[model samples]
Target: MGEPNTILHAVRVSLRMSQDELAQAIREDGREHGEPNYCAKRNVQRWESGDVRMPRKIYIRSLERVTGLPIEALGFATPVFGTRAAAQAPANGQESARGEVVEMGATSAPGGAVPMTKHNDHGTLSGIWLSRYEYHSSGRGADFTGEHFVVVIQHRNKLTVRSLPEASSNPDSPLTMDLTVDGNVVTGSWREETAGDGYYAGAVYHGALQLLLEPTGRKMTGKWVGFGKDFDVNTGPWELTFKDASTSKAAMDRYNHRP
Candidate 1:
């Protein structure tokens, strides 16, 4: 009816929610790198009214989830985050001002928020993505029964993941694994520690995860291996998709790390 509302404001309206409702929802998502009350209603007003230059990556990521709107549609100019800036980011769990995810930056528009920075050769691995793997032994013939719930965290180019078995006694327990990306492919390994035995037959569980980026850049598919005494003993396939497509809403597992 009237002139179109500002991009951020329009998104909030499209969801039939008030600014306070969206603000409260964003605060609860709670980015590990964000501050207390960071997404206050006043801040939302600022972003909606064009008072702020660019929303930081943390808020951008959280708001995407809160509003179910793509960050690019919010209309802020994306800024490129350099290596120096990333290295200089706060070390006390606080994050620096980052817009673009350098090595693994935005490729398209469905999964996470789009970076406002100039396009570059490097790609970014920021934002949330769900990982699913069904592990089975070579001769076990169990129809890939070992299922692990996994989530990936991409900050700049460095990546980390926390995974736990679906039937695990310790669902609160997460195995911290790290990986690096080469082109669309990502590979890494982590050693796991648990009080009880693993989901597999033996008590030991250590493995490598490989992911191939889809053309849409929002999804990845790969295989993972659960190595035992001789290495690469147990193997299976895994898939990673954005939060919206995931049945497992356990998307924020990255913040579960303890000091």
Candidate 2:
């Protein structure tokens, strides 16, 4: 087997994120950029085991965004042009599909401008969050409350939030939200897949949402309008609160088991 990618592994550990969390983060990041990604725990395992020396270009971009590190620094070999390697290179001034020129010593990190620091600030919504919602069920004629552990990733004006499974062995009934930030208002859409054995009978739900960011930037309060199991339009209050700046396993467990 090839040498293990300790650099990649170490960075993930420092961020207090597990392999599964990293994979989910990367997948969410790809979706934010309109890229379809199938990243999973198995992919992270291969990368850390050195079974795959270099991932595809889309994964590379996601890695850069999640880790705030340059590809070369992550133990990946960037192709250097000129010398014998440039013999088969594209002609000069010719750009790749992404408009990047393949030339001698042209290795540039996608997020080189961003400082390599732990994301612990409120300036960007890139961390763990607690999602809570309350809605009245027509069948029961009572209010129902739900909570979830979610990871929020913000890339520029775009934000993606995805719920995490309670445990590795448990199946995920994922809830995903895609939102855009304009000043202090966040407008977005949300989709959720109900648990198969739950009260909803594994129904799929989706709707539009709009939230106002609190002055502290640690809380978002909003309302969601969606079709319920009865096929009737329902509205409810939804909120997301900043929980932890780190995605460590301990943080995840704490949020998952919240009271």
Candidate 3:
């Protein structure tokens, strides 16, 4: 029973491996050195519990040979290896200091031996959610006076549909069109219909809402044509800001600038 043996057992338990597994691994490692009988489950347990002392060289080498981990990493018994003091020392000095320190349960960093960071989702137009917007002209003598809304497109039936929300003046038959992003083309028409003489009337509408990505999410941008029985409308360019539950500004900047 010795300090080295006790530490070795602690390392084995931390790794969640049983004594038999470690013993077999050790036996396999010993074969490389023509000392094939060096490991057994019983022997490993006695060595780990400090019931017996391990040959220093065999003990150190067996760590890597048995567990496929580096010798320095098996210094799991110490908790000060990850401290700022350890980082300032030379490599060999750091290893020595780490090895000498007794197990204090704080040697390992908060992120284990390796660093792990979580990914943020934002700025990408993940096809998991939907978004929409509307545009209203704000000038006199403007060709378009009524409010024109742009619905962020949702994929459906091999087509992308972008529509304007129905206005109180006229609910059904709102401005809308189908767009194909891959080809950069839009196909559809604006048709005006009359409901009752007072609340609704036949107005002209044209202009396909183009897709655009904004700081928010996928947005639609386009112009309004006219408000008559017969009007000619055309497609306009708009950016659809990609939006998702996890989209972020930093992510968007990186995505747009990536090579």
Which candidate tops TM-score? 2
lDDT tens string, model 2, 84-121?
A: 76645543322344434334223332222332233323
Compose the digit string of candidate 1's lDDT tens values, residues 1-259: 1111144543453343577888888888765435444677876765655445356667878877775446754545444435776655432221245422222222422223552343213455444445555754456655643323444444444454544333232443335456666667778765455445544433546777887877676777888777655564766787766643221224233322221
lDDT accuracy of residue 190 in candidate 3: 33
Off by over 4 Å in 1: 1-124, 137-141, 145-151, 164-173, 191-202, 229-232, 244-259
lDDT of each: 0.52, 0.69, 0.38
What lDDT score is found at residue 16 in candidate 2? 53
Off by over 4 Å in 3: 1-145, 148-153, 156-173, 183-200, 207-217, 222-259
Best by lDDT: 2
**Order of models, best TM-score first:** 2, 1, 3
Task: Please identify which of the two predictions, 1 or 2, would achieve the higher TM-score against the true structure.
Answer: 2
Please give, for residues 145-196, the per-residue lDDT of candidate 3 as tens digits: 2322222222221122222223222344333334333223223323333333
Q: Cα deviation of 30 in candidate 3 (Å)? A: 85
Ranking by lDDT: 2, 1, 3
| lDDT for 168 (candidate 1) | 30
